[model samples]
Target: MTDASALRTAILTSVPADPFQTTAPEPRFVYVPRTHVRALDPDNMLVVGARGTGKSFWWQALLSDAARATLQIPSMSRGKLQVGAGWSENTEPDKDTLAGLRRAGADPRQIWRAVLLAQFDSGVDSMDSWKDRVDWVANHPEAVAKLIRSYDDAADADDTRHLLLFDALDRTADEWTERRALLKGLLQLVLDLRSTKAIRAKVFVRPDMIQDPEVLAFVDSSKVVGSRIELTWPRHELYGLLWQYMGNAFQGAATFRRRHSGWKKDETGLFRMPDTLRTNEQVQRDVFAEIAGKAMGTNERRGLPFTWIPTHLADASSIVTPRSFLAALRTAADETNHDSELALDWRSIHSGVRRASEIRVIELGEDFPWTKPAMAALEGLNVPCSRKDLVSRWTANSVMERLDGLPTGDRNKNATLGQQGLLNDLVEVGVLEVRSDGRYNIPDVYRVGFGLKRRGGVRPVT
Candidate 1:
């Protein structure tokens, strides 16, 4: 029976203590339902979710296990698509070489040819020349019609489960247009695979990236084919995931013990353990109550349940990772360890969660200018407005249009763009929603943020 403190130190030293374990780490956690790694079958699913919702954790977990089975970088261009400018003799002759050539006024077609050659060489050893590779696909259209097709055939024939996980596509520094193009192109490629039935693509995208017409186009095809899965976690499920991960990191050292063992066994697992003589369930309920109290004063926020304590705790470490929960806990542990205490702090955890949310909001805002205005307009209207109605009334365009017909103070594009961009920022921040029929609506979660009034006012309440 090792003490909790001694166990914590041993576990800390035993584990690498990295929350964002982009590389690898030992797995000790149970497969909580929320974070359960799904079997990679022939299904194209686009998984979209907010920050700290177990997107990356499950992604990495699948990737690590399915390494031999998954075709990670299926791009024919291999690594060339990621590289940008620069050339130094002392520097690496990376994929950026092609980007450098393009920058030096090289023909785009020629650069593409070289990249195609590189890809063929690395991906298809059977191919000899770039022309031959291109001709092979052209001559045998069905044989090599699309990148995903070839991979699919190979995967299906072997009964292999290939999980194509695309994470951080939004984080790419490519220009807005380029980013949109790349995603649309990749999605189009994925769309090509449905005809073959070989691999499954799961993309973890923030809501903003999915809102673009071009980006949305890709998913449309998949959705029409009925091959998309939205990533959402109930509060309880989310809490369960966090608890499972943390419990694993702590292993069975008395500090973190399980209530139940095997299905046929009588051992209690972590959920059955007692904290300060209180059962695990009781302790969890108490902790959640405390956290919810801090998040929303005892008044009880709208969407969040009054007894809301999801088994998992949301934090940045979970969001930025392939990292294990223990690793994230360790990172937080390191911060708290500075105070010579081996305990996790609620304040620090709460702050980490807030910081994670803020970063996501900022990123979404920058990428999607249309997001804010859409949200603000929805907020101001206090009710769903038709797409045309919103654009005609709530937007700066609407504002200008109203003022312009007055023969004084006409709408200005620059001012309108500035104002509209700000409003769009709100939408991107997940505070608003643009409905299918062109209407704009707010999520129930953010309804409180908008203080609505039915009274008539000359100026719209933004």
Candidate 2:
């Protein structure tokens, strides 16, 4: 086979089938972005990001010693930290039981304390139900405090730190008010633990959750909010991640490693990104051109593949997530013709964008169920349109009425939003954009998925 075909095979096999499937990412798959090093610090209590970013991925990654070593964070590289999930997508029993405890009039703060106490003291774990544990914790604050102190004392002696990670807080309750209250209690618990030297709580939260005024309304709330780090994947970092995966693949590892002097294998035999690849755009573009050609097509007007791929895949806020970027390239590799000179064909890259959009829309529905139906109301409607025109479409389709019927936690808020409020909600999530001329536009990543039309947009695959 030719070099292009061999490279295409390498990419298709190396890229993961599901980039968002972070329940147990292998150590080889962990690519650390330079900007995310601060986010991995145990001192940062809150880490926020939009869906498809690496919030859950990092949550799971931190739990693995191999993955933690790949991160190379000074505090975590030693592997001396004790990490446990206080709450996460996988901790369903804890969520359901905590919801029950809340209904039983148990204080959310006490409930969370019980969660921590159970981790350190087996007796707390012996309790059969959440209520029983919460009751025990509430009735015995001194005992709970003593247990935490003893644990911290041990960690201090060992020169180690204990971390409790919280993710998927939105799944804690069905009602927004209840979820907000529960989150507030968790944040307060994080603050309460701040005084302890060896015990810390890190919360991986959605941006919208922490941004709500009601959620952070507490004494010293800024202490948590002020130190929060956003999990973002800049353009160069996205390309860096791509190279990491490609460079580590068994079939093309030698070829890819030789192409760039900066790429190196670590002690674990996984590829580590160089500073130049992470920060230098021209270097990344040069490396990308080797596989996909100098430009997207024969001329510059068609756009450079290095820039076009990310530009089209970006959300309204101009954020291109690692998940979407990887997914698009993987699909492009799969669709590229075997006889083609490029590893990823320009036409296949466009196909990759469509696949990425479909995946993004599905993820949006999973995170915010109301988005699909709400966006569906504007199907076939051309973007860069006036707010009045957009509202007319929603009004004609009874979009508000349809949204009210959904079982989302934000149903009440969405129903009360009316047409104007709904538009703002979409804009806030990076699904829709408002132009400087007061027109509404949907980014290609979402526009194609929602079946919306644009005068010169990438068309959706029929």
Candidate 3:
């Protein structure tokens, strides 16, 4: 198994510190689901899952014409999709700028339409101000539509399609109150984009924003919601992602490929993997069995390795993100030892789980800064604890008393102050897991992140 050591070397060399920032190359992009491929057909929009759900990765990947071509979604093959940004890091003006237009007596919906128009007609940029752009759009609604249509007609004439992408709107405003108007206006604009067949827009919305009742209050929410796809990883898919990476890593290493030769005995003596892996049952069984053997624990009471890793790493929603999965794999590989039963020894895998939990904690802290302080209060408190003890822990750390000081940052714009309500909030975000007995436990994904240890779990290094 010297080649396995080489495989381990390749994995360690490839593991990125921030998995979200890393993009799997075209040949390596096997995690995408066919639903995502269909949703990518310009007209269908998907509200990506909470952070780390491949929202940003897709945004960057689809930006490359080469990547779009690999999509193999027949609709996109005409030519490279002409991508425009309704909201992106490089193009969008800040919240203050949008607020400036709002202050100028500009209707937010109209301003959003103006932004859409600007994407089609670069001439809108020559105008002195956003107000000027707004006025121009106000004066020529048909012209705006006609301009967008013209671009589509040109693309069609050239045998291609045009698509507009919207992502990272959460960056537009810090507070939900400030962000709501911006999103509501943009959502209306997206809903309206449906009328046009040539130019389609893909809006990557956050789940909480779109799911919020107030945000859905007045609009024909169904139209926008209907086009939405949520980013989620099933138990098997998470494992598939692991083998997909290893398979790709194999392609890069000629020596490793020469050594293992091929796992498929009947096929040519060379490794072969698809550009993307969906639910290929054979591939999952062979690749993972090679890495972690068949069973997870001594007598199969602990389940299979393919099942155990993803199951333990899942958040409250039972979703295992690629980020967490990879983190766990990298850690397991790093910690494997002589006494280990499998290539990825079951015992050694816990350290990976532990590290993934820590990274997840930090990421959650970044996503919800206020919740960080609140989560820290219960750091050492073991789970399966009663709500009374939970509240008592918060009270002990003065987190309950400082509820007023905790930043009420929320996706739905509703932050809780009451103890039980706050605990429920933690559960909603996958920070805490609730049990049938009304007791709560923190999943290992978040247990270490929040600095909490289970009653009989691993101790923190301090």
Candidate 4:
């Protein structure tokens, strides 16, 4: 038999190296639709999404002329856009400043305005005493406006637009209640900023940020919720992403060559890429079929590669992430490569599925430390169970006993949510799903993460 392992290796390596850290669209950057572009508007002020769906990628792209151009957002040509004058959870100074202000009881709106002053007012203070400097700028909007106007005049343009982007709201405060207050105040500030035409703010947040009762207390957030963009990946889009990655993978296949040749000769693909980047149906089917063959394995019973992978990767809320999807492909290749196979075998794909589940669990543990600890209590217990069965596992494992100071991935820190309350909290975060039948079933994505197995689902937890 001819050696085809190298071909398989090349095919695997052709996809993106790291889907999460994808810096450019070369190997793969999914196109953000015009509707999504409108939703991403800095003027829209609030963006809601889960862990994936390009929240971080979109936020980072806006900072780069190269990245912005690739997205083909209509707003880019609208004006001279100046990025991110406001605040982000990524910056140390911004995080510390907000934390300090919250520690000192400063209003979130005031703190946000102060952050904006750093960009608008050149002479604005950039020191640790950010509160006093921000307060000073707050008392003097004319100077900032003058600074803004002068730039508009110098550019010979009608106006200079400033965008304030906020992301990673979870990092704002480790203490649950304090974090909620900080987010609430920041939301109010965003709503208030709508009055200012030239200056705008965009917030990228996890879907559950607004779930706290106190955060919504007395605040009319209808406008904010309406603007929410749930970062959901559709079935076709997921397949489209697979094809897009393969098409860019620099593979020697005629199919990949044909698609990549277009991108190589056309400089426009890198910037202001066409709307039909990867939506070609024939190309998607041909490329995917070339890699995995017709079915996931020998028989149709094993499930098709395009459908089976995404269906298994999705969480309880039916949300699938690019991260998990890519992870499975890479893992499948890693597990079964160098075997005497033309492509990933059915057994290997399922193995990849398990590996992806495990990696996702570790990721969750990092983000929500309480994720494993709380869920581990149900290691041997199967799910889709009654409320009593769920509580029995928690009590048996002494879950509440170990929750003190554990991070729940949201407010209400200190494991203050008793057993039942913890279950409800998990449901809200997509960790646990409450069914219409009132029975609680854990999603497969998280089942392995928590080491919880279903009756007929994943293999027995080792």
| Position 33, candidate 4: lDDT | 43
- Tell me the TM-score of each prediction against the true structure: 0.53, 0.95, 0.86, 0.83
The total number of steric clashes, by the backbone 3 Å criterion, in model 1 comes to 27
What are the lDDT scores of the predictions, listed in order? 0.40, 0.83, 0.68, 0.65
Backbone clash tally for model 2? 0
Tens-place lDDT per residue, model 1, 95-159, is: 34423433445432232223332333234336664444434444454444455455546656775
For 20-47, candidate 3 gives per-residue lDDT tens digits of 5644355444445644666566657655
Which pairs, if any, clash in model 4? 176-411
Model 4: what TM-score? 0.83
lDDT of 4 by residue, 90-200 (tens): 563466666776777676666665666566546665555776766665677787557545643553455667777777777777666777777787787677666666777
RMSD to native, candidate 1: 11.2
CA lDDT for candidate 4: 0.65
Runs in model 4 deviating more than 4 A are 1-11, 14-30, 33-35, 92-94, 125-128, 138-159, 218-220, 250-265, 269-287, 296-298, 339-341, 366-369, 384-386, 404-417, 434-439, 455-462
**Clash counts for the predictions, in order:** 27, 0, 1, 1
Choose the strongest candidate by TM-score: 2
Please, what are the lDDT tens digits per residue for candidate 2 over residues 1-462?
676776777677678877667566777868888788889899888999888888888889888777776776786755378888888867734667777888789887888898888787649888887778889999998888888888888888898888998888878887777888999989999989988989999999888888789988899999989989999888888988887777777576666666678766679878776788768899888888888987766787889999999999999899898888989999999899889998998888888999999989998887677777688888888888988888888788887888888776756344575777788788878888888998888899998888888886688645
Q: Candidate 2, clashing residue pairs?
A: none
